[model samples]
Target: MGGRILVADSVATNRIALAAILKRGRYNVSMCSTASDALQMARAAPPDLVFSASELPDMPGTRLTERLKAQTGMRDVPVLLMSRDREAGDVVSALAAGAEDVMPQPFNELALMARTRSLMRARETDRALEQHQSTVRCLGFSEQAPDFAPAARIALVAESRARGIALAAQLKREISQPVATLDLTGALAEADSAAPPDVYVIDATLEAPGDGLRLLADLRSRPGTRHAAIVIITDADNSMAVANALDLGANDLLLVGFQPQELALRLKNQLARKRRADLLRASVEDSMRLAVIDPLTGLYNRRYAYAHIAQIDELARKTGRQYAVMLADIDRFKAINDTWGHAAGDAVLAEVAKRLRDNLRGIDMVARIGGEEFLMALPKTSDIDARMAAERLCALIARDPVRLPGSDQSTAVTISIGLAMSGAKGRLSLPVNTLIDKADRALYCAKAEGRNQVTVSRTAA
Candidate 1:
């Protein structure tokens, strides 16, 4: 509501009307008559939102939207379409063409204001999410145990040493960070170094004993820096070089002879892209965590457990190795909730999940399948190993009392475990449900024998 809005239309009257409306609503409005002019204006000073008529003097509003979105920084700006045609099909087409919203002409002022407010709110939400995701990713990167300095690092591998050094200096000045430059001379010698820069800017003209493309491919293939962003700078605007760069996962292609200012701008654009990609990756990981993780305990939930078991079962069939499944349930867990309240129950579950994680091998999968039940899949493990692991887990829980925060009482808890193992032939081809059922039966047997014990299915032996 407080920021600038760009209103573009070929028709003077339409532009004036929209500008007046936006101005009356306390928005700073910029008016333009052509798509090309709108693009220039938007790029120079991007508005909070854009309202463009479908028919522009130079190009269609759809094309304008596409062009603006294709640009480095303006991709996320919201564009609304205003057209006189007003047909449902036209509105659909405009939206499909990248307009965030479409309003038919002969518009109602109230509806227009409402839609504008909604779009603005949506944009603000998206921007906040993007920022949060970026922060989370940067935090995650920083928190890695090895403490890699990815944020402050840059690498420039170039053919022309003088040009590369000059560009590296400019880049360091522009970004206010140090950059490391390497040429064909240093590629093989320093390839195994512990620290690789976050970004690799390669000169496409580098001709060493091996192929230049192969060098790019090798840099990308390495585990330490596989995820680093790559940029290819070429002397000629060769389509082949550009295509090869793209094929080898180069993030951008830049012409070598650009002005210093232009070079800085291009470097800034690539850095922005790198930041956005980090944000996107964090968002995806967060979404995945929400989908499959139990919020209370930081363990995988039932759905993910099922999926993991199915995959492991298939792998067992192919590899012909023994695999084990274990189902664990806290004994008399409902009484804990009833006696101490749900908060205490949650604390108990959290403690149990932590113990399970701490006790198991890194490759083992453990998940919460229900309120007080958990499922663990141990691959390449026999029945004896599974029973030994379960016994240790059960003994630990029985001996350790969970101390709830802000409470004076400590509640002792115990777990019953049921384990099932596939035969030496490795693959049971049994349905996930059937495998779970076997473990569930074993769990029942454990409870029947006595709580705080481990029981293995007879079939498993």
Candidate 2:
């Protein structure tokens, strides 16, 4: 994926080199020689990724990472630290300081490009999710709390049982999260589980060469584990495998074998990233549900009903099939609210919604379009069938009284329904709004003729 990257290095040659490589990969590259300049540039407009040398003129690269992360909009922008022959302690410190990874200098082109692609893809996804979440919050829904970090579940998969067990034990000691050891088959089985591992540490060459890469692809494809973070461990000499692992959706990689602390820190970062993604997905789902559903009666609202009617209309036009639309109103609903209070009216509305929803065919659509007013549609229905259905609905509501909130007493309730049909012989198809208006006129006829009855629209107009 193409993205903007900020490259900060004191050495002119190093900045040029990195920029050339990134530009070759189709990334827009910006450069700065000092940490202060990089900070200023980034604050003005955050890049998709940042590549900073561990040694900066004014401040250390890790400090730059810390500062960028502390910035409000820049927190999710990943930072990659370039280290030349850096010690293990330095790598650990950089990671702990929130750098995405510490890349070795005189970079391996294949590994560098693959890692860059991986980072860019993840950053793009994060940005899209954040944009959706922001839209949701703008619709008056609360955003998920950032500080909530649930305990992560980690899985250790190795070529051998002993190796897997040993690594699991080591990981258990380094982190407080639950750890489990699984072989290739066991890991595959996790794809069927409801709560699979939040992260999987897979040793390359499980049963044969590149087995772990296959597993990574499989886990990423499965719905249950598709969003789970995966880290692949490979030999330092196997740069091709490292590149392949990242290309196949491995979240991170471990070369020169795994150190418990380093793996733990990497796992922590992956877990936190996955949590943010999961919460954002949940928030989007909640917001979408709220947008289309009526909170009062737990039924679809006017907005959704209109869209659904359009769909039904289109389908009827294509298939030349008959469909029914009905406008239902609770008779004398205002008097109930005035006499017993809005609470009793709410109770009655809820009961009526439930009755309508339960009694209708599974393919039928029912929604509360307004207070004391509902919209129902039945596809592939005849006028005779529609009239019978409407009569049944009127009887269903008037058959028994609805019990009031927190009271033993009950009040009698009735509904008047107006029915209109599509696909009448020699008649042209009507627009959805026009059909609704016809149903409304029929409803007026029903209310005028009697309080509790069904009225079918006969005139084409």
Candidate 3:
């Protein structure tokens, strides 16, 4: 079975009809006669999605959807409203009230199942992102407030420039934002730009038949534009176009000519969705960063250092360039730890990290891989420049005294650097781990020769 589904309707025949269609698709279908029963059954064992008629004996499907969303755990479950032919206004209201979609009966099987699969796929994605729910909540991203009057970027693609301009002007009165009229030639290029549209409104009858649908596919193919909201506008009688558009990755659709107020409402809903997805993406990125970054010193951690070294090695191999690796260890770090508390030792580490990070080029990466030890990668650097950089870092640490947070005392510190380079000629065949090992060996050699100095590995020269 694809997923569990609950069908809620007042009439038995109506319930059975929808259930049979879902069952044909191998979904686990559960039937309920009233909205009250539907809620109880859903709370007992929540289904992946719900198909409820617009009117029930006790309540409307919109009310049922609202009730389900009220619960903390069931908020993500999708609800599709089934509206009779006479209920066009109700269908619009239901969608605005938060139903995933409203299908007018007799439902088009393709659109229904396509919508089902789409919603289910979204549900699964949300479920996966829930793994970071705790961290997202800690960052205050879990609770997002909707903007009352939405201002968003809109992309309008129509058959003619006049119709597109007219639509843009009509929309501009209701909401304040840039509504770009796009031709097919400039569509993909604009999508690649830094600020792509927030919502794309494309006319179904374009310069030629099916061009609008083709454009939707093109937009989704690009990584940067895939997440942008797409709304299709088509003629009233072309029911098949609506279905095709939905199945072809259009996020929302409207039939007939333009109405400004309804257009505003639909665009606002899309903007809200776009903002929410952006927030979730950002939260996941933050968690991923936290995993590989040292919270105290704000430097890359050991795990990131190892992976980064490999990436640099691959890039060097492809480009026929040399990369430098350096291991830095603070001299007599234990004495500082013993003389002052761990907090002062932490202060010293932070100071050293700042100096090393600020002095280097953007192409360099530095990580704290051990207690009082740091590792660095400098890509495409010559042996002389690498040695000069290592010596400069040593001097920066010894130049200043790191002050304690509370006490009026200061601690002086210096670092010893061990330098190794992937020989500029045969760097492609060299293993990154060997470079790291060579750097470690030279780091120890520097400590032996005396603390607070720099040493270069023999293999590097």
Lowest summed lDDT over 10 consecutive residues: which window, candidate 2?
130-139
Which lDDT tens digits does candidate 3 get at residues 1-461? 56679999988898888888888988889999999999898888778899898889998788888998786668778788887762556655776667766777887777677677777766655553553444345444355534454456789997899988988899899877778998877777789998788889988778799999999988988887898899988764566777678778887877664467667777877787677666677665565476767877888888767866776776567546688999999999899999998999999999999999999975588899979999999876888999999999999899989998799999999999999989675546768888899999999999999989999999887
lDDT value for model 3: 0.81
Relative to the unseen true structure, what is the C-alpha lDDT of residue 13 in candidate 2, on a scale of 0 to 100? Answer: 97
Q: Is candidate 2 or candidate 3 better by lDDT?
A: 2
How well does candidate 1 score on lDDT at residue 128?
42
Query: lDDT winner among the candidates?
Result: 2
RMSD of each: 19.7, 15.2, 16.9
Model 3 Cα displacement at 438 (Å)? 38
| Rank ordering of all candidates by lDDT, starting from the highest | 2, 3, 1
Better of 1 and 3 by TM-score: 3
lDDT by residue (tens digit), candidate 2, 1-461: 26679999999999999899889997879999999999899888678899999989899999999999998679999999998875778878989999988898989889999999999889867765665455456556645566857778899999899998888888888889999999999999977788899999999889998899999999999999999999999986778998999999999988755578899899999998999889888876676587967888888788767766776676567445678999999999999999999999999999999999999975687899989999999876788888999999999999999999899999999999988888563453677888888889999999999879988887522
Task: Name the candidate, 2 or 3, with the larger TM-score value.
Answer: 2
lDDT of 3 at 14: 85
